[model samples]
Target: MARKAAIIGGGVIGGGWAARFLLNGWDVAVFDPDPEAPRKVGEVIANARQALPALSDVPMPAEGKLSFVSTITEAVEGSEYIQESVSERLDLKHRVFAQIQQVAPGVLIGSSTSGFKPSELQEKAPEPGMIFVAHPFNPVYLLPLAEVVPSPKNPPEAIERAKEILREIGMFPLHVRKEIDAHIADRFLEAVWREALWLVKDGIATTEEIDEAIRMGFGLRWGQMGLFETYRVAGGEAGMKHFMAQFGPCLTWPWTKLMDVPEFNDELVDLIAGQSDAQSGHHSIRELERIRDSNLIGFLRALKERNWGAGKVLREHDERKAAAFFGATDSAPKAAPLEMAHMQVLPGWIDYNGHMTESRYYFANSETIDAFLRLIGAGMDYVAAGHSYYSAETHIRHLGEAKLGDRLTGTIQIISADEKRFRSFVRIMKGEDCVATIEQLCLHVDMAAGKSSPASAEVWAKLKAVADAHANLPLPEGAGRAVGQRK
Candidate 1:
């Protein structure tokens, strides 16, 4: 059954919520007085459609219907979830919450208020237990974290339900143990923002320089391994305790003005704006967002492949989505020489000759193997259950040159399979011509025992089926061919 979600305000955050829910297969109805709400939300959804799928190979759920309604009641009526993103005013929230509760008495209400606490939001509501702060980061469709903070009056079941629904839409719901003015992530951001203001005010760093200081350094670290874990690694063999003891006194030093705020005078505003313009005037905001999304997709995908931090979350979500996709199908589709990979040659793939580099061919083959693994049910759950296919060896033969923007595809032929081992051939092509060929041998490993093992009966059956389907196909000449010519 298709689920429904309601958004009370259709600004950036609300539109983001709409895009997230809509893309994840939830019908979203948004209520915003702004006449331009539909256009604005549509723009955000367009960007989301371009970015979110680049993060994983698992096909996203079919997009759901999006409607812009006139009244909050029309938006929230019969909806499974309701998110309020109105102005950050306590009085306004009280009015909104009262209205939402009256219309959909028991439905969960998530307030996207960065400044207000759940207690403040629910103080005047008829059913306070259902109202909580489900604050999400900007570009909500792309970023996964949603801070779920409940008041003392909130029912535990409501909190869990909020978490469950957030996870359903590919969000990492962090439970805030206690409600505070600003949640955990915002608290950290506020500190840095305060310090940046001080830096700009004191002429110590331009806005662009301050941004570079972050994006080129700690920002990258924080993205993969957050502050504590990154510092733990920096602590070396002695670990966190020793490192903390060594640097504990620095906390008292006047190294930062986190408590102070620079006046929002025109001089400061002009200075910041001028620096920003000078730094990034070349690209429009939409173009910049696309660039940012692309960069994030690349980094997130790499991290996911390694199963680290946010990457682990992404991998887990993709696995669940894949499982759900297969389950919803009427019957499992037959696999025969599956076209497992399709991608344009990224700019980074070019070499000095302005052609695709040598290593990318192998990388494409590796991706093909990953796709094949997913097709045969060797997804995250299979690995989680302590079984996986690990590449033992690979041989590659290049036939033609590929350049930037070339549309590349890799077709995987199941050469042979057994209970313990499998061999496959991947033909890399640009359009119809074969550009490269890869012969790979993989072994099913008992991850817990750290040795080769027979594949699970179910997995073996899928592989055997594919191999049987390809039985009549001739093996590529590159298969079993040695790299060196001997006398």
Candidate 2:
């Protein structure tokens, strides 16, 4: 059964929580007093649908059902997890918790308060142990960090369970050791925010200038290596110890107004707001959000390729999905086109004409063929061991259009095989319809010598079995046809 998550507020953070859980295959029930909550949350989910799948190497799980409920009571019904993202008012949060505990005191409840400590949130509560902090950054569906703060009143097991749930939804839960005013990340950000305000207030820099200083410089470094590591690299060959010794003394300098506060008057607000409007007012919030999402996807995918930092979290998620796929799979030969891969048409896959591009069609086929190769033991490890199958030629036929968000299935039918070479056919399907077909010839090679080579005995046995099963089936219509051939 699909697990359920209750989202107490449907603003940006709450909606992001909904999307994260829903996309990870958890049914979500959302409750927000705003009458426009449905439209608001729907927009966030639409952004998430395009952004999240692009990060995964494996197919995303079947999306869970999303429902907007009338009350907190309706939202928390049968919920295994609940995230409260209501307004930042203390009394408002206390009342929200009281209502939640009144009905379902046992269900784990988390708060998305960026500034409030867990102790503050847990006070005046009948079930304080169930209420803790789970502060996430904006665009929670894309970014992975969740600052989980638990007071001493909370049980260890419950806190661990909270972390596990966060990880399951592809979040990296940084457990805050003690209850601090604004958990780790926010504190650092608050310092930067204050400094940025001072810079604008003092006419030292414009909004766009500050943004450029970050994005063109440290922001790129920060995205991958983060603050300490980036500075550590700044230390040169001696590492962090050398860095701290050299730059640590600069901490006492009056380089920043870390201790000073700018007066918060109309003048200050207007300076910042007007500058920001001039900096980014041309694009609507949604348009800027799309731009941000696209940039983040590119950055995160780069990290995933290197298997470093936030990318590592994404890879682990894919690994978890792969484990489940293999454990439940029975790959014995059968008289059918073997379903090898499941894919989605992501944001970058569309061409100028708005159809899935031709390259992606070949990519879809390659994914199908690669999965089949892995199943038959001629995969990456086999290549690393100096023997593998390499595609010599391919022919693809596009029969129908596949638009964005369309789910695709790639299935393979083996036509024939020998010791050193094999021919196969693949069909990319959308539901019951086949959108395209690909036929390919592959040759096993001795990598060191760069010549055709016989397959390993074990791989040959498996491949021959599947090939033998497919031999009795009628040949796929386009199997041997050359380009521009008649019907």
- Best of the candidates, lDDT: 2
lDDT of 2 by residue, 353-408 (tens): 88999999999999888889989998899989999888999899988999977889
Clashing pairs in 2: none
TM-score of every model? 0.73, 0.96
For model 2 the local lDDT of residue 143 reads: 98
Indicate the residue-level lDDT of 390 in model 2: 88
Give the candidate number with the greatest TM-score. 2
Please report how far candidate 2 places residue 191 from its true position, in Å. 1.2
> What TM-score does candidate 2 reach?
0.96
* Whole-model lDDT per candidate: 0.86, 0.92
